[model samples]
Target: MTHYDGWFMLAAILAAFAANEVWRVVGVALSARLHEDSAVFSWVKMVATALVAGLVAKLVLNPTGGLALAPLWLRLGSVAFGVAAYALGRRSLALGVAAAAATLMVGTAVIAPGAPP
Candidate 1:
């Protein structure tokens, strides 16, 4: 490849990073004045939580790559178990995440239709 091609790729990567960081810069600028008890902060928290939940739902419903190998029901069941673990484990997020991962592993081991007999 030509040297120009490398420069072009670097420029594209820089452009992508700049685009992604614009919001981060804005958030940092505004966060200094934001209070946790304020309505705006509450709204932001809600939106952020909803966005994460939506992302997780999307991954479970329409997984890509290796996750696609697991059935949707298994993924959903794992998420349910994780949530229960989170509640029962005194809100320990790590426990919840571990439970979800363990559930997925066990489900794959036991019910993988394509596994060798």
Candidate 2:
């Protein structure tokens, strides 16, 4: 690639990183001023939680390639099992991840026997 192309790509990545860091710094500053019990904090937490939930739903519904080739119902079922595991495991991240992985494997085996590697 040309030197200009390399510099352009570097500048793009740096810009993205700087944008994310700006949010982090703002959050840190705002957090210092706001108590956790404040209504604004609670609303922010809810919005963050909802955004995460939406992202998870999107991934489960339409995976990239590995799991996307599997049946839709299988993916949905695995996500449901994962959510249940997360709730039942007292919201433990590790246990929830394990359950989701296990369920995905089983679902893939049963639902997409001829899926390509």
Candidate 3:
């Protein structure tokens, strides 16, 4: 590798750290005055939730890498299984996620025996 590559990588790391650090500091400063019950906080929470939901939907519908190898039915079914587990397990996030992962693994194994383990 060229000598300049190390300096470029260092610069990229510093830039990323600075970009993230600024937002973290800003968040910390704002968080002190924000109340969980306040409208602003609620709005922020709703937006964050919406973004996460959108991301999940996108990933499930149009997956990448190894996940893309799995059938669409299996992907969609895993989501359903996860949601059902979440509701049935008293809204336990951990249980829901675990159930979804297990479903995907078993389903993939059963349907595509040649798939990488």
Candidate 4:
């Protein structure tokens, strides 16, 4: 791509990100009056959590691009072990990431030594 094209692309990306943040900022501004324990807020939180969980599940079960080369069982097992570790460690993000990486490494070694490109 030309220099001008790259600049245009960068500007477009920045504009998209800024547009997305506007809604987030609006939400934060309105949050003061919104009851934290209200049904609507609770439902929204649940939906958000569910969406994240679904995305994680999809990534583990059917990873895209480079990850698709790995064995399916290895991915699923890694996620399971990671969830277990996270629960045992009281939902610590660092421990969860480390556990997931460790699990993925070990699982791949044991299950898919010759996984393809």
Candidate 5:
């Protein structure tokens, strides 16, 4: 006996959309009244920054798939190398992401699993 069918899936999708959109609508309404330099805005900025940093730390510490094949120190060192490339390249966003991805792929090839580092 299955608990879910097409109608159930439709309801789940609609409910997910509603749940996601409600907050977006609220944020849109709130955005109009918020000043860019206000305390609330600063708090929001700090929260956003912290969330990004946490995500990056998580990725570096606990990677998945191909990234998981590389050792932890190499993963972290590649991130540092990418950040250095980004800063030295005038803080280009593309440069940073590309450098990090390339370093990971190449580093993985050089010191792949079942081989010495």
Candidate 6:
């Protein structure tokens, strides 16, 4: 509504964009010299993998919203099915996730017939 407010909002947006873009530019510059076999890259990969595993554990053990609707047994069983599918399907991450999601959906539908999706 005010003239200065519009300019302030524009400046804030530009600052946020610059803050994010700087990291991306830095990452690109750093990545050019880093080989996949380098120790630094290996460490980064390990850290990233650990973070993903932690996130998955958190989501499975303590889900919220729609996921929390299902019983704990269903959640753990779905994870078991996913891991088994992943191992049986040539270790394909996509197949494992899809199997887990499908298991969860079917289990929820069967276990809670009137539950909201």
For model 4, residues 51-85, the per-residue Cα lDDT tens digits are 98999889877789877766787787778888888
lDDT of 6: 0.94
For all predicted structures, in order, the TM-scores are 0.76, 0.73, 0.86, 0.72, 0.79, 0.86
Model 4 misplaced stretches (Cα beyond 4 Å):
1-18, 109-117
**Cα distance off (Å), candidate 2, residue 56:** 3.3
After superposition, the stretches of candidate 5 with alpha carbons farther than 4 Å from their true spots are: 1-4, 113-117
Candidate 3 lDDT, tens digit per residue, 10-108?
999999999999999999998999998999999999999999899989999999999998999999999999999999999999999999999999999
Model 6 ranges off by over 4 Å: 1-7
Give the poorly placed runs of model 2, Cα more than 4 Å off.
60-68
Per-residue lDDT tens digits for candidate 5, residues 44-63, read: 99999899889999999998
Q: Candidate 2's residue-wise lDDT over 1-117, tens digit each?
A: 999999999999999999999999998898799988999989999999999889988887877968677677877877778889999999987888789889889777777677654
- Best-matching candidate per lDDT: 3
Q: Provide the clashing-pair count of each candidate structure.
A: 0, 0, 0, 0, 0, 0
TM-score of 4: 0.72
Error of 6 at 78 (Å): 1.2
What C-alpha lDDT does candidate 4 achieve relative to the native structure? 0.85
Model 5 lDDT, full chain set:
0.88
lDDT of each: 0.92, 0.85, 0.95, 0.85, 0.88, 0.94
Candidate 1 lDDT over 1-114, as tens digits, reads: 899999999999999999989989998998899999999989989999999999999999999987888898899999999999999999999999999999998888788757
Write model 6 residue lDDT over 1-29, tens digit each, in one string. Answer: 69999999999999999999999999999
Residue 106 deviation, candidate 2, in Å? 2.0
Using lDDT as the measure, name the better of candidate 1 and candidate 6: 6
